[model samples]
Target: MKLLRWTPLALALLAGAGTASAQDKPDPNLARNLAATCAGCHGTGGRTVPGSAVEPLAGADSAVLMQKLRDFRSGARPATIMHQISKGYTEAQLELIAAYFAARK
Candidate 1:
């Protein structure tokens, strides 16, 4: 009788824990989605064709990429389009993007 009474409570608690765990984990697709914007010009996965005018982002140094992104965001870097695009991302999102591209190679 006690086990039956406790079963529903235990199930509810377990369900609640699953919900909390899901909420606590960042969305796996978030970084990819955020980085997708860059693909229009940066090339897919930041891999540009050889001899392209734009620099390939794949395997870029993370520190340099982050700094460049920060500069664009802060208006320290002059850009034809990146300045505007960079403004769209939060600092944390930019960090995720930097990490994403830096790992692409």
Candidate 2:
């Protein structure tokens, strides 16, 4: 009789445990998610709209992208807005964004 009464409590605890574990797992699309912020200017997958004048990041060299981002963050490269935007991300996040765009065709 006691075991039967406790069964519901045990099941509830188990269900909550599953939810906690799921939340603990890191998102698999982190890089893509991080890069999505750039879509406003860089275009989807880093391909700028035709004749848009904004430089396309798609298929660019990762090293070059890294340098450009670093410059933007450091104010070494003058920009109307990029310098301000670049300052928001850490180096690791910038690297991920660069890698994601470089991989896109």
Candidate 3:
């Protein structure tokens, strides 16, 4: 009876799990290039730099990351470092960067 009960529960869980991955599609090329600038703080190969003051961005969400970049570009989020860097980027470049990081696994 225990084995029979467990089978139904496991099948339900497996069905639910499949839907979660359906929405997680990411672009490959963008993720690769965006990695360059990200490496400055987050470390190369998506690893966080040891004892670095900056927070790691290895697996951050794409939409959230894009909005942050947009905010930095617009002077809405006011970080001196980000403000300076964001100013140098074009809108296209920003999109590419956002797409790249968002694609990270």
TM-scores of the models, in the order given: 0.75, 0.75, 0.56
Flag regions of model 1 displaced more than 4 Å. 1-23
Model 2, span 2-60: residue lDDT tens: 99999999999999999999999977798899989989998998999999989999999
Q: What does the lDDT come to for candidate 2?
A: 0.92
Backbone clashes in model 2, listed as residue pairs: none
**lDDT of model number 3:** 0.71
- In model 2, what is the error at residue 42, expressed in angstroms? 1.1
lDDT score for residue 103 of model 1 = 87
Model 2 regions more than 4 Å off: 1-25
Model 2 earns a TM-score of: 0.75
- Give a tens-digit lDDT track for model 1, residues 11-102: 99999999999999999999889988888788999988778888888899888999998898888998898899888889899999999988
RMSD of each: 5.0, 4.2, 14.0
lDDT order of candidates, best first?
A: 2, 1, 3
- By lDDT, who's the top model here? 2
Which ten contiguous residues of candidate 3 have the minimum total lDDT?
Answer: 22-31
